[model samples]
Target chain A: MKTFPILLKTELKLSLRGMDMLIFALCMPVVMVLILGAVFGDRPAYDGASHTFLAQSFGAVSAIAICAGGVMGLPLVLSDYRGKKILKRFWVTPTSPAMLIAVQLTIYALYAFASLALVSLTATLLFGMRLAGSPIAFLGAYLLVMVSMFSIGALVGGLARDGKMAGALASILYFPMLVFSGATLPYEVMPPLMQRIADALPLTQGIKLLKAASLGLPAEGVALPIAVMAILALVCGGVALRFFRWE
Target chain B: MEYIVEAQGLRKTYGAVQALRGVSLRVQRGEVVGVLGANGAGKSTLIECILGVRKPDAGEIRLLGMHPERERKRLFAQVGVQFQQSAVQERIRVGELCQMTAALYPQTTPAAPLLAQFGLAGKLRQQVSDLSGGERQKLFIVLALLPMPQLVFLDELTTGLDARARRDVWQCLKQQKAQGLTIVLTSHFMDEVEALCDRVLILRHGQTHFEGTVQQAVAATPHQRLEDAYLWLTDDEREDNA
Candidate 1:
């Protein structure tokens, strides 16, 4: 427990002091939200509500940060540490590999929360959008999505050989989730076949589950998506931990 | 006196390459021993086996009278180590690194005194990346000595240092040895071994060909020099490779 906080502090300091990862974690998400919000402004989503696009899309934007940092950002960082022998150096110390992993998860969760807050603030103030569903539900959905995305990232980062490989793997997962998962393009607008493929993606289910929460809709239909997200979270998270390779 | 480090009939292989082949050696308490070897002579493998970093394929290893592989963590605390190229995060300050590493141990001396003693008192706040090679080496030595360990392993600790820095490190080692710490080190510098090692072991092809005082090792060679003796020990090794 103590090791987690210590390592988290060190990681956070490193993240802040370094420019590249900081831009990837903080700058890119804010830029994406602003650009997407501006370009998509005044355009109505599939629903006729003028402001529906902002509210729902804002949730997607938050999810983007979670996916980008947790899925892509974190694994590269962890793999880089391993490849550079930083993790190997720690192996000689009293610190266990498990503690190092815990620290990474903690820092990523913090980034997720920070991104969520920023996106929510931008949508509410700049776009004059209101969340349709219960705030508690929104919070719950956001946390679940963050955890699911982070687990996937951890699995990839742990299994990859180096930073380049981790970055490639993360990109393979991220772009599809961003584009085809109904985060950027609404699910109903996509072809039926594409919709089926999106349905198979964890991000698509995550977005649907989040949209249900933000729209105040009954979650009875969301059981399937939620179940899928939960299962992906478990299986990927377990495999990541079990087969995690540290240099 | 009981041997602080003992290995018997040790053997290790990585795929087709045999790193250690029935190699055996022993170091008694408070002895400053040096392992002189050419590239691929298995000095590092022998040290790693003793440190529990690598397990021997055959035979046994004992450090401080306990099995190293099974009791790694407990033995690690009792031993101090400086590897070939130790590196911490570039942005991490020396003081912070010292503090962090010190916290990992159950008992530790304060970093302030160690820094001052190593002539790094002014560079406590300086990031590790900014430090010169000698300063980094001194920092590592300070970290290794923080626990007042009974046995210290230094692998080519003076590799990149200038003559003055090398002498400083040797002096520090001598002082530390006077305080009753057993030192085991590997060095390519013949003068370093002659100046410091109470006994020198020449390793070639993962076996000890010569083990005695510096004078005896030098006297055994036709050329009567540490370098010549090292070459002589590995002459058969070169022929076998050819």
Candidate 2:
């Protein structure tokens, strides 16, 4: 465990040098929040909703960073390490592969929460957007969504034979979730068929849980979404663990 | 005999390909042992099994008097290895990689003096990707030696090096051997094995074809160079099998 801090420091330094994850996971979501807040500041979110558009979309928009980091950034880095034999190098040392994976997850989780905090601060200061739900419940939903998204990345990274394959798989999962999961485009504006399609996506269910927690709405009918996110997290994470190739 | 490594009846198969077949060898303390083999001759498989990186299909192996599979962590703390294809993160600086690796072992040689000894003092702040291939290989050797380990394993340690860089690495290995470090190395360069190894083991078709001192191996094919002797030994086995 003593090696954890050294490894984390090295990981953070390496992450800073790369900066691609920083731009995509940390900077992009803040930019989105600012743009969405400025352009549609006071528009009503839906026919019967009392919140403005930015307020309604806040939960989903916050998840954009998670998706970027978890689906795109995480897999690319892990697969690159495997391709370069970095994990195999560590396997011979006192530090094991399990420790490396744990450290990576911890680093991405830090990025996700940092992105969340930045988005929340920017939204509140720029547009007076505030969460209406229990802070504890909102945090719980945020963690669940983050874990579910990262699990998908782990599955791709753990199974991919190389970086190219991981990148291809990550993109296939990333773009669609960003556009159709009600994270970028509001779910209320989608056609009936699109809504049904979006409902089938893990991120869509994650956004629903997030929106309820953020709006302080009773999670009366959200049991299914919660269960879906939980199941996705478990199954994907389990598969990733079972099939992870250290070399 | 104070054997640093001992293996018996080591058999390993990857699907239908037999990577190792009943290979056994031993190395005493302070001995420099060179493992020589042609491509796919099970030198790597033998090393991996002994290092506890891979399990043999049927064998018993011990490192430093303890079973490697059962005492991997304990064994790794005392043994350092430089794999043929292993790499550090490209963006990491030289000093940082050294420091991180040093943190893994209970005892370590300080990074600064060691880097200077290897002619890498000025490259401490340089990223790994920025270094030349020889410099990177030297850095890997430095890492493998940093733990002050009782034994070290180096695979193709100077494969792509210029003569000067190769000599530099050879000098460092000689210094370590002089300090009573038991070294196990694999190299395609026959002269490297002759210059550095006290004893040489040649593997052919996943079996031990020859195991003896460099002089004994050379004398076996009298009036021939070590490289020719090596080829003659392996080629003789190939002919016998045919």
lDDT of 2 by residue, B1-242 (tens): 79999999999999999999999989999999999999899999999998888889998898899887677677788889999966777689998999889877777889888899888998988998899877888899899988888999999999888998888889988988898999999999998998899999999889998999999998987446799888877786567787
Residue B198 lDDT, candidate 2, scale 0-100: 96
The lDDT leader among the candidates is: 2
Residue ranges of candidate 1 with Cα displaced over 4 Å: A31-47, A125-128, A175-201, B237-242
In candidate 1, how many Å is residue A92 off? 2.0
RMSD, every candidate, angstroms: 3.1, 1.6
Evaluated on the second chain alone, the candidates' TM-scores are 0.93, 0.95
Computed on alpha carbons, the lDDT of every model, listed in order, comes to: 0.79, 0.88
lDDT of 1: 0.79
Model 1 sits at an interface RMSD, in angstroms, of 2.0
Error of 1 at A199 (Å): 4.6
